[model samples]
Target: MEMKERQQLQYEHDLRNHFDILSLSRLDRLKHYGLHFAKYAGRLARGDAEAKSRNETLVDAFLVALSAANALNQKLQNAEVDTEDAPSDLAFTDHAGRFADACEKIDHLEEFRSIALDANAAITDWIVRNATVRGVDLDALVDERRKQLAQRAVYAPGS
Candidate 1:
């Protein structure tokens, strides 16, 4: 099964109310994505972070990017268009840096919204590209993660 960005966004949105993720202040949401992205990228780059494998870090980064994109109001309607091959030369750190720069610049431009959303899609594309190259079953991973999120929601303090 292919990893569909729109579907992933929908799943994140569905879990938003339960986790109060999307409702977070813009800076907080950006921090959420940034921190997770940095942590996972560190693990993937250094081969250290808990007992998780590199691919697991990749999945974490990918999911956070998708959720961050959605929080930034990226409609993800351009997923098909953005699915075109991203440059394979960039390292995971480069990918993480680009995403952080993108998110950070959202407040710096007069037309930053569109530009940031484009960056959001671009960042997601790079991860998807890496996943494909590494033969990671993103669909399966996402499915498992979403299920876990749903189950957690059941016992959420306010849910």
Candidate 2:
């Protein structure tokens, strides 16, 4: 199935499973939480305690969505969209939007964060295992890609 179709199905599943737990009325509320959290987090480094709190709250919601997606065997890269092409008005209609709501409803963002971190670490470990078996270093391949990007930047116009 296409990414959007998968997201739609996933959202439907999340709604069926967690809607009772969240007590949320609409998906848009989650979108609002995410949007406000991001906008606020940008100012968090400026010493705004409230913004920091809000930032964590929003992140918590995102983590909940991530957890749900993982449970449903969904791919994050497939669910994520290009920022420029993302719909501002229909924010509540996508996987990202559902994540925003989940984060907002989750009071303990730290647990969610740790879970995400662990998941990433596990993936890295698996990749390393497979690469070692094949006599390849994934990190070196990534570094080579980065070097190529840097070289391109150096030769680019007005650089």
- In terms of TM-score, the best-performing candidate is 1
- lDDT of each candidate versus the true structure: 0.62, 0.39
In terms of lDDT, the poorest run of 10 residues in model 1 is: 77-86
RMSD of 2: 18.1
What are the per-residue Cα lDDT tens digits for candidate 2 across 1-159?
243453454455445444443465334433343564345334333445454443242333333434343443445443222233322212222333334435554454433433433333332223233334444543445334334434444444444
Candidate 2 stretches greater than 4 Å from native: 1-110, 152-159
lDDT over C-alpha atoms for residue 21 of model 1: 63
**What is the TM-score of each predicted model, taking all chains together?**
0.68, 0.28
- Cα shift from native, residue 130, model 2 (Å): 1.2
The digit string of per-residue lDDT tens for model 1 on 7-70 reads: 5655554565336766678767875676677776667656553588766666666677777766
Query: What's the number of clashes in each of the models?
Result: 0, 6
